[model samples]
Each structure stands twice: as C-alpha cells, then as structure tokens.
Target: MVKFLLLALAFGLVHAYAELEGTWYTTAIAADNVDTIEEEGPLRLYVRELTCSKGCNKLGVTFYVNANGQCSKTTVTGYMQEDGKYRTQFEGDDRFKPVHATPDNIVFISQNVDRAGRTTNLIFVVGKGQPLTPEQYEKLEEFAKEQNIPTENIRNVLATDTCPE
Candidate 1:
C-alpha cells in the first residue's frame, strides 16, 4: 500500500506540471532598484503548475535573461506551496523569495526578491497571440541594442527569429 501511494503521488505531480505547461507573455518588466525596461527580447512565459484553489496547487517557472542578445539562466525553476505563496526559497537559495497572484487565473504576477533583498516582479499572461512582425522585431532589436537588452535570452519565447504569420 505504501509503494502504491508513492507511485500515485508521483503521477499526480506529473499531471500537475502537465496542466501548467504552456506559453505565457508580458509587455512590461520591472525590478527593484533597477530601471524599468519597457521592451526587451521575446516574451515567452514557460510555466508548469499543479492543482488549484483560486491558484495553483504547485507552480514552477523557468525563464532566461537577455545579455546582449545572449541567453542565461537567471531564474531557476520554483513552485508555490499548498498555501499559495511564492515567498520562499527556490533552488535552495534563500536570497530569492517569490510570491505570485493566482495559478487558476489567466493572468498572474511572480514576485521575487533578489540577493540584495530588492523585490523584482515578473508579470505573466497566457497565450501567444502572434509572433512579432519583421518591422516590429527590428524596431525591438534597435530598442534592445539601445537598452543593451539581450535577444538570445528570449529565443525560446520568440520560437522563431522572424514572425510566424
């Protein structure tokens, strides 16, 4: 019976993640003590969550930071607890404490605290309406260059270098 229960629990976790797997996006990004960068690279929101009670039972998020069109892992995967709170340690690091809006809702915000104890928030919106147009992408590229925003970091979100439509 114990073994069976463990197996069931494992499957349940997998199912939970599957439910949360999808593409998400946001137009604005702001960080604590850091100047807000209105536009950046691609906007792909990769998330996996479990269960829900006006929120997710469990939630894990993965995102990359742009550094001169280069990509790097900035936020490791982390999830919320049963109490529905992200204000906890992720990847075994205490510096980063997070909090989110709601898992069940179409829109949610992931609030994170940096090593300096500054708060940074990641806004999440579901669906990829349409890829950015060439003109739009180029304009964004120019802005990214001006802002020194990395494009490679957002490659996953873009899916393709050019617009799909």
Candidate 2:
C-alpha cells in the first residue's frame, strides 16, 4: 500500500512539472514605415485562461513556474500588460490544442471561428514568468513599424485607458 501511494505521488509530481502551464501575454511587432528606423511598441496580451480537452484535461489561470520547473497557481487569473494596445479583441475557441508546451513557455495555434464560421489563425504564446527582454522588445517594435502602425498614438492609448485584465 505504501509503495503504491509513493508511486502515485511520484506520478503526480512529474505531471506537475510540465512547462508553459500558465497565463502569458504576447505582442506582435510589425513594421510601421520603410524610412523609419525605430520599431513600434509591443502589444500587450492577456491570456485569461487555457483549457485542454482532448489530450490534456487541465485549466490554468495565473500559474507561475518555479526555477525547479514546477508550475503553481498564485491566483485564479494572471494579469499582464503588454507595451502597446491590442488591435482586436482576444476571442476564439474555448479549447486550444498545444503545439508546444514547456515549463517556461507555451505556443499554441488556434483558429478563431466567428458566428458566421469565418476562421482566422490565432497564435498564442504564454510564458511562465518574467517579461520580455530589451532585444525582444526591439524586435516587436520593428514588427510594428513594418505594419505601418503610427507610433504617435500608441503613447496616447497606453496612457489614457486601462485594457481589460
């Protein structure tokens, strides 16, 4: 009986150590204009929640990954702010299939089907902890610039209102 209990506990621990098991906010960087040298600001994202039905039956909200590679929920919902505003609402299917999951990061590709059933590709990346680095920030800025998004209004948007958490 003790051996069985220990085995079960071990299994549980192993299952608990999987990465990319929390809420992460990501932004896409696009180019603004050809002549401009600086990239645009990073877009903020709120993952809200993640649910897996087919392969993994787990729901994660605000979970943080430890240095030892264990994920634990600090709260029911994780709150994060990206550098810039979101161009559109974060809406889509309730369940997202995992293309990749690790202790530190998760990447999932999903399709957002509207009421009319028009589908759009949605790519999500959730980091376990910490924010984007300076280099990453630069990359995002460049991407925004490429997209031709005006930088003049980004500061206004970020300063005036609070995005949904």
Candidate 3:
C-alpha cells in the first residue's frame, strides 16, 4: 500500500503537496534566503519525487541556487503536518521557521529558534507576477516584527525581484 501511494506521487498520478512544490523565486536580500548569489535569479524550491514515506509522506524541499550560470541544489526535509502545512528551514537555517506558503507564493519568517535575537522575513513570488496579496502582508506582520525586521522590508524583499522576460 505504501509503495502504491508513493508510486502515485512519483508518476505524477498524485500531487502530494501541489501547493508546496515549485520554483519559488525572490530578490529578498536579507541574511537567510537565497541572497548568497545575487546575479543569478530568485531562490527556488522544487519537490523531490521520492523522499520518505509515512501517513502524510515526507516531502523533500530542494533549494536551487544559480551562481555564474551554474545551478547547485540541496535537499531539505519538508515535514507536512496533519493540517496540510509544511515546516522546513530556509536553506538549513533554523532561524527561519516553518514555510508559510500558498500555491502562488510563500511567506517565510526568520527568528532564532532559541529566541535569543534576530528576525527576518523572506517572502517569494512563487510564480511569475504572483506577489503576496495585501492580506498576506498583514498576516505576517507580527512575524516580521518578532524577527526584529521592519514590515516594510518584507514588502521590499518580495518586490525587489522580477522575473526576466
């Protein structure tokens, strides 16, 4: 039974987390996102077909970073809870909390797990021109504050990048 279910996702018969899988890009230049490589493109996340199997199934979140026209990738476990929410890190940074996401975009907040200090938000336009809605901004405002970053910065980060034509 597990093999069958896993095969379904592997063969495209199922979209385990359709909303969470995609090439999400952002020009947000804080400390915790895809800011390490500036000239490439927005940071991206894509699903790994086979990661782990369980009730909800373990989703693999791969970050694609392009540097000098070459893209390098890394995989991270995106755990999906029963409520259908995914909790993953921002490129291995525990400072960034669970991925606040939607099919069109994501709102990721970065606050140290220990809560000693530091907060930042990395919002992305998952699809072309699919910027976070105004309501979404209002939604993550507290997270932005808790991360010690100004809400304006979230807007700026998500808005700074545009897909190349």
TM-score of each model, in listed order: 0.40, 0.38, 0.43
- Alpha-carbon lDDT, every model: 0.40, 0.36, 0.45
By lDDT rank, best first, the candidates go 3, 1, 2
lDDT of 1 by residue, 1-165 (tens): 999999999787555545555544332232222332223332332332223333343344545544355544443434455454444454223222222222332334445454566554433333344454566455445544443445432232434222212
Candidate 3 off by > 4 Å: 1-53, 78-99, 110-129, 134-142, 152-165
| Top-lDDT structure, candidate number | 3
Candidate 3 worst ten-residue window by lDDT: 41-50
Q: Give a tens-digit lDDT track for model 2, residues 1-165.
A: 999999998767446434434345432211122121122211223343453222233334432222223323232321222421112222322233445455555544333344455444334445533454566445434433443444332221112112333
As for candidate 1, its clashing pairs are 51-57, 59-79, 69-150, 69-151, 69-152, 86-98, 87-98
lDDT per residue as tens, model 3, 81-116: 565544566533333333544455555443322233
lDDT: which is higher, 1 or 3?
A: 3
TM-score of decoy 3: 0.43
* After superposition, candidate 1 runs with Cα above 4 Å error: 1-19, 25-58, 73-75, 87-105, 129-165
Clashing pairs in 3: 119-147
Q: Give residue 114's error in model 1 in angstroms.
A: 1.2
User: TM-score: which is higher, 2 or 3?
Assistant: 3
